[model samples]
Target: MSVLVRRAALTVVAVAATVLVAITPAQAEPEGGTKPLRDALRAASQGYQDARTAIANAKKREGELSEEILASQARVADLSAAVGRLAAAQYRGGSSAQLQALLSSGSPESFLDTAATVRYLSERDGAQVTALKAAQATLARQRKDLDAAILEQENQLKELRKRQDEALKALRSAGGGDPTLGFGDLPANATPAPRNPDGSFPSEGCSVKDPTTSGCLSPRTLHAYNETKKANFDHYVSCYRSAEDGGEHPRGKACDWSSAAKGFGGMAVGAEKDYGNKLAAWYIANADRLGVLYVIWFRQIWMPGTGWRSYFGSGDPSSEHTNHVHLSMR
Candidate 1:
């Protein structure tokens, strides 16, 4: 072969090799798979840590609340004692010979003294009763609010524990497995059979589709996802739908659910570069049973890559979503 032709052929072959290496699916448990799993594990671990912290905080609050209740009880007791003293004084004054003598003296100064003394005793009794009742009412409200807060904290801890268990299970299952495998060792060239874009599942149900409408998922599918993950599927769907439909997401844009399982768009990175860590966490916990893997927000507007890291805040640039959750499967 001519030198020029040979060089051109070599260059083409090198380029092709690079592309194949880049696009070829990695082995089971490839770094790609492991990365997302690790990220999810980290997030779950963090959640566990947070739950522990919250429990501690709740305990502290309970202690403080108990003290408050005790203090309120003490105040009530004090007020009751004051009322008793006032009652005794009033009773004595009303019947005492000294009071009677003052009233009968007929001197203007003596009569004035008796009237003042009676008024003072009556006012003091009324004031003590009012103060006691007010303290008791205040304590009741504080106790109720504190009790509710404690319940909420307990629920949060329960959810955290559930997620932790799932993460641990995944880690165990994936042990010594290649992290780069897509869809549990499925071939990378295996394109999923096309389905109706309207978001319906196939009869055999190897893959599931999400509705084009914001936040639409079949009740069965939602139940399956929630049951598998032991997480709040409804809340997730609600949040996604709200974000997609609230006028910010352009019409006709739908979230990509399958990408989540396939590790699309460098999704494996958990530390900071991973844009969809929370979404991935949900997917990892639910994907096995749901046949769903990823979710994407479909929109026409361009979102700056700068803000992808904030999972809970206002998405990219728009705030139009007000309802619904997106789902995907592979």
Candidate 2:
């Protein structure tokens, strides 16, 4: 075949292969030795994140209510003082003073002016009283809401503790012996995922097309993947596997970033380990922004509430996650 014809044929074959991957059902789980461990990590991480969001929302509401209550209280105090002064003036003046003013008027026009002035003072005092009442009512309502917010914060704290305990339990069951000095912080930035008005992540589906694989990813996962590339950590990445593969991969809420430039390889060491460390630190630093559930790298895992714990999977690089950084999103 001519060179031009051969190039066209190869292009067609590549397109066909991509289509096949897109349509192919996920039949087997990836990484055979780590299914149970991945499952536990997902459960613990997700629960901790939910509790953390709730607590943050409750704290924000509490702060707002507090500010409003302070303003309301100040208004009420000022109104009360104004009303008190009006009452004192009325008591000191008494009816005698009004009658004397009317008697001293020299003409009908003068008497009419005195009467009008008396009515205006009474009406003004009444309005002040009304305003004071309204301010008090508003203050009461705000205090009640503040109380409820406090209660909500307390309840969410309890839930947070429960989730933390569950995470610790998961670590113990997974043979994670103790906390380790995990990857340290490195300066990295990621575009924040869109959130609900209350600062919670919006529920998403496997809708966006995964760039690395033909499978699909949630919009959040896709954003995280792109942001990682922007940070110049681009290596090999695969996201959106079959749900049958387990954990967030099938749900399109996770990605596996290989340390090797080409793909997954043997245990990452030296520069490769450094790469994984930086990547893991970047995810942790941007966890809240990206709604990260957990990050697993180099035999350690980081969750929302639980910082870092030893995580050893069945004896293999994939299971141990020594060769890649695993990121799971909320």
> Which lDDT values do the candidates have, in the order given?
0.43, 0.82
Off by over 4 Å in 2: 1-40, 99-106, 243-245
Q: What digit string (tens of lDDT, one per residue) describes model 2 on residues 92-117?
A: 97567878887899999999999998
At residue 136, give the lDDT of candidate 2: 97
Please give the RMSD to the true structure for each candidate, in Å: 16.8, 7.3
Cα lDDT of candidate 2 equals 0.82
**TM-score of every model?**
0.40, 0.83
lDDT of 1 by residue, 244-276 (tens): 212211211123322223222222223322223
